[model samples]
Target: MTSAQPSGEIFELQADPEVVDKAALEGQLPGSPLSMHRVAKGHFRVVVSGLRTDAMLRYRFRVHRKDLGRWIQVSDPFAWQLDASRQRWSTRAIGLEDATRKKARPLPRRPTFDQLVIYELCPREVVPKATRYADLVTAPTGAQPRFGSIFRAITRRIRSGYYDQLGVTALELMPILAQGWRRATPQGVGRPFESPTERPPWGYQAMSWYAVNGDYGTAAELVELIDAAHARGLAVLADVSLEHGYGGKENGLVTDLWPRWRVPRPKNRWGLLELDLAAPGAFPFVVGGLRRLLVDLGFDGLRLDWTEKVPPKTWKRVVAEVRRFAPEAILISENPTLPLITEAGFDGTWDFFFHWEAPLLLRRVYRNWDGLAKRLVSTQRKLVENLEGRAYPPHGAKRVAGIDPAKGPPVVRYLESHDLPRVARRRVRWQHGGGHLMDVDGDGKTPDWLNHGSQATSRLGATLLATLPGAILLFQGQEHGADDELIWAHDPLESRRDAKTFGHYQRLLKLRARLPVLRQNDLRVLLSDDKRHVLAYSRGEDPARGDDDRIVVVLNFAPQAVRRLRIPMPSPGRWRDLLGGKTYPCGKELTLHLPLAGSLLLQKLGKRQTLGKRQTLGKRQTLGKRQTRAKTKDCEPARYARHASKPVSTSR
Candidate 1:
């Protein structure tokens, strides 16, 4: 194994052509997957693409050390011995340093930087049909969400300055595996297979888990995408729905090949395609296929959707087998109910506590503040205990290294996801209450669902999601104020331009990624929730990093205002609003100029992993001439004089 050079830089991996040439002549390394290209006389480069990176900034490098007969894993993504003229290699922001001795090293598991923010976007849910590339919904026009067409589009996003641009470190994609899709039409879209007049592009109703959907791109395309992501410094995770499958729809597959495959055709409309993990051959076919797919493709982690539904015992075996294929694979289970799953083998379970349950409780329509707090307490206690396994602890919970009280797998927290009513839909549903689905008014203007429900909550939710500890998963457009509920319908691409939620989301993403405390798992408990009027909590290592240290978070959820906001902390310093760089008073109590209770982002005032890389940002492209002029006024003075201000004092 080889170590990457320096921390926080991007290094690439190239096949040693000299060695490859020798091997090619003698037949050691395979030609189909591995290739070498020439550089200068003395050195050759083999660029390995499709590696995942995080804010920690690590590169995956492979090398062959003569000392060790077998090939060795290198520290950096790209490596070369005695390449003195390599300026590019020396100037990257990677933490993994190059070896001076030119000896092979093993790749390490820990990230150089501790904070990693993985954004989740069910592509079809976020990007609307008929949405043109330019019709980005923001009135002022902001940055576009880094979305991809091919699997590589994701890599391009990681490298293209999207996540990097947005300040997000790692990236997570909803199932890229085979999801049957069709053009939105009146009949319906995807597996339900409706007329063009009846479809929506939401991919929840999937078809096959083994094959990568053609619309999203091919398997090779996916590989290229992952490799590109790694180069861009992103740690990638594949979200797999191990709980159920698309079995039993008009669902037709070659079951005989996988004799255990069960496609049940239930009588009910909402009937799911469930698998009996207890069944024979069923476990392997279910587990093996995905395990093989992930290892073959090489992803950084796995997000198991709804592991709660899967029997715990069965899930244990599945996880054990998955580790055999890729041990460094981060296991994240999206089970809202089973906080205990963290001990079963999962690195963490989705803290639906923060994502939905807690929020819903804060909303007051569902659960009360006490109810929410109790739920948190109940689950947290159960999770705190380590269930002894035959080998190690039962996958209940294990405190992470370097993070005290950070004992649980990360809680995947979110505001708006592919499921549920759009943020706006929820609001509208609460207030005026109308559509089962959003409908254009007779005047042709879109419904106010986005502005009221989806739009408002989205902005607020983003702020809160970023402030919460554990992990924050960004759904597409939530930052930009997505107005549409992620409901699937069969129609032409009509809704794309209507939703203008990308800019806010992009801002939110960068904020969340910059804060390390929000990424740490500890008790970010919400206090003083009188009938869900205000949502508040504390996150991070509180007693202090060496001793359970953390930052306190308090929110005034009342849509009106909160002149005084009180949060619990051992003591306080000036609390800074990480969102707009605003600072709030600290001590026993703090006051907040509350806009609404839906959401926000806050960090304790102190030195931490700073936000996005500091750069003289280029002029942000404005949408209209008026906005452009405003931007010019804002950016020109800084841009021109800074470059022009250099004095010609060369007389010395």
Candidate 2:
């Protein structure tokens, strides 16, 4: 079978002879109906005598079904464009490259996965309610008002230079595939009902893999937005769903065209039909669509949704094929528990370890602070060990054979995502609720719940995220401490912007991008003060190189200030506080006052100053005298504890 060229008159599609008996193509113009001849078991082709290459040619395929004893109309599964209202295939038939290749300008340099600080946003939430157009007056009365599309809003953001200013290297957009044409209900038993609207169900219930969501914009508009991003030196990643499609057993594709293409949904969850990867001609179809997205649509990477639900072998095969075509593409899985991402040939996986445990640390749930710190360290170590194919004793899992560890950590640490409730609510119901909301103070009723303490905890979380050894992701509005509960098809933080919180994240992210030590995968615990609720650690690369590039992070988890707290110094000399822009002298330790949930990020200064013998002696005497007095003030009772004892050191 011959396929259409960049400007050809012939069109081709793939179908199994075992599934389809005969096929015909239909177009909108005169002399519409065209016959398709089967040249091979899985190849079907048709020729148009005088077809235009510039204008969109709306068309569909009519297939003869043996089981139903009737003909059925189906859209081309490989169509680059879709007529949303009609649910038909619409394309210029000018080859997929004409969409993005001519429009997307060259980027200065594409960032690697390790260098990427990803920002994930849902397209649905980005569309503005109403935008005023200067020239065209669409509304009858007042100023010209037009409802903006998702792509337009995002293009405006890119032109405004928000992402560049925010220091994010890549934009990870949520699924943009055709969705929201129908709803899945228990009564319908996987039957689809018409429910088209501006806002869809987060684009997870995808209708077509090859078509752009109509609500967002046309395929051309989407390409322009991506080109705008590339012009600004930013990479774009597409979040895709491969586990299942939107419709069920009653769907036309499942019942008529390709019955063997689907498998039973596991436990009938979500009433969605799963794709049978083992089916004949399935891999080529899936891989072709993915290639179109990456190569033709100009996407730099993919974030596969719900990857753990996909069979391990199927996932491996998909990764291998995608790598064969797009070797530099970044592939990250949504599976957080598994550390063998490199074994499956994935760049990274979601860091559920940090997502699950970091909040507990912020809440100060564990009384034994040192023990909790050790557990956190141990958990991170186990992740490394598992990636290196070492035996894990806690889970009784042996060494995974034939796995090679990558140079960088295979995790993407994030504090908030679309899957979980906001951080404020999570902290309020700190005890139980399975990361969901309960009847609590943080349920939007208590404004005080989002006060000073909450912001401090968020800043603390951001500090840990920046200093951690992996790629990082910040969900929409997360950089500014958005605390609204994640409701389906709703985004509360879209209209809210806190300059202070935004500035905080901007400073940290920019620092992380510039500092070599922050990007490296080396950490050493320097101090853990259980009584004062403080933890200090040093992060750097190559210890033998000394303290030039070493960074020290000291965190105070207490709700109240800790006065005259002395933290041990890794090296004795002068040190500079990168965050506060202050310099201090150190012998064996340094003393400072820490605010509520405050942190100090310090780096050793190369220039050292020596003090005279008498001056050093006098300083030591004064510090010793003040240490006794400071102890009484620091020995306050723990707020969350009853009958607390005097503060004491329990560092390891």
Candidate 3:
């Protein structure tokens, strides 16, 4: 094969000569067939004139397999758009002129990294079933259930202020890129089913990095959805799986042609074919795909999936190149106990520690409540320290060349995610023993204790999550008490108890936005009571300064109400409960009555006012009847005995 600069439209295909004997470009140019010459070993190229650079170009490539001995049509590995029905490729090869004509727009205005509240949703799942099948009979084969209308529906809702009301600043879209549809056996071999089955709801099994999922929607529709979100002041983040690709029958680009791109032994836990980043041209291929998603299409950021599988050196290079061009783009990692935060220069990573350990504390399963309290306080301090770059440099602090002192890291905090079970559906297995406590009930089994007060427990978790420092995430339907598990075949947007749970989240988010101290990095543990199952923390720029901006959050995790609970305050002032709209005067210590599974958001009052008669705070709404009695025998002082010599507050 030889190389040359062509004057007109050029098409190229890189393949193994042993696999492909011949190739041709089948386009609309009215030619019988445009034969492609072998420009290099295992490489073919064709150039044609009379093609309009401004118009959308549609074409397909046909290759004659050496084994099959007949020409067959296959998709281009680098196609921007694929006509799933015809199995064709589309592009406008205007070259440099195209870039000049369509200048990339600046990213939409978004809140600071610390203030981000991300709402994750799958595009196909958000739309109703009836809507997806409306045009099924009239549409061509494999073209029914088009998601373009769903994109428009979401865009309409965004324009209608739905997201603003929900108080989320960003939308994290699940994978929409072309994905593998082939089923895999228990032995991890991709196979074709004799009969068709419903496609998976999630898009984790990626087929083409560049092509938009035709089943999901057209590229134009996706662009419109993102643009509309931006207009509504909502940043859009794309979740990309760079660790592995679909190794099914559909991935002919790698299987039949570029087999060298696949690793000798797949390393991904998902049993998919992992990409060999060390191979020739692999780095540029991945980088080009990233540029397409972030530069050509305007995505505010990316939530990289399975970041642990990728090498830190490769991630560092990828992140450096992306940051060089898109400086404001936020890159998040998805490794549980991520060790690459600073090395890869990601803005944030999933807080798996919170996801795994928070339930243990909430369930009160520990024998020593003091140990649990200490663990909770220390975990929170570690998170804060990581974000502030005190213990480790923040995500973006380490670039390709050296440390970048200007960039600070954010944290990704959530109770429910795509990987986690919903709070209502979660069954607490022995976090230590790995055995869930189950009870038989009329031929059906249910988890004991966890079923009781799930709603209240959910609210408690949300309260603690929202007040902590991080980019908080609320999975789809999680804010509205959707108890069903994530079904790959079917996902409904609405739930039975939407009003109550939705209202709680709406109010909680609005309160977080209204309070400036909640968005800051400073945190101090004010109370961690073991006996009463109560905890309190203060958030502010400086709680020791005793300013009016200081905010204290008190939580009661007990199954029953606790009376005369006292928590020390930073200063002598009148504090108001923002959630319940109650006020109390405090000198150094504040005493209060809290309901079962209750929480309080207290903000210091600048001036003194007459306090109303003390009333018991409202009890949080619960779901089940099962309750666990707390052990109140072991009594402790207001502060930990180990910290008796220190001040009342523990600021890390």
Best by lDDT: 3
Per-residue alpha-carbon lDDT of model 3 for 76-124, expressed as tens digits?
Answer: 7776554433232433334423321343345467677777899998877
Alpha carbon deviation, residue 643, candidate 2 (Å)? 42
**Which one wins by TM-score: 2 or 3?**
2
Q: What lDDT tens digits, residue by residue, belong to model 2 across residues 262-333?
A: 665444445555677778866677777788778778788899987877767777888999988888888998
Q: Pick the candidate with the highest TM-score.
A: 2
Cα-lDDT of candidate 3: 0.63
Ranking by TM-score: 2, 3, 1
What is the total number of backbone clashes in candidate 3? 4
Stretches of model 1 off by over 4 angstroms after superposition:
1-116, 124-159, 179-207, 248-252, 256-269, 278-280, 339-343, 358-409, 424-456, 488-512, 522-532, 535-550, 564-576, 580-588, 591-593, 597-652
* Cα displacement (Å) at residue 327, model 3: 1.6
Per-prediction TM-score:
0.56, 0.79, 0.77
lDDT of 2 at 261: 77
Q: Where does candidate 2 stray beyond 4 Å? A: 1-8, 31-35, 49-54, 86-103, 131-148, 185-199, 249-256, 337-342, 363-408, 424-453, 488-494, 529-532, 542-544, 608-652
Q: Is candidate 1 or candidate 3 better by TM-score?
A: 3
Per-residue CA lDDT of model 1 for 304-348, tens digit only, reads 766766666777787788888777677777764443453467766
The C-alpha lDDT values of all candidates are 0.43, 0.62, 0.63
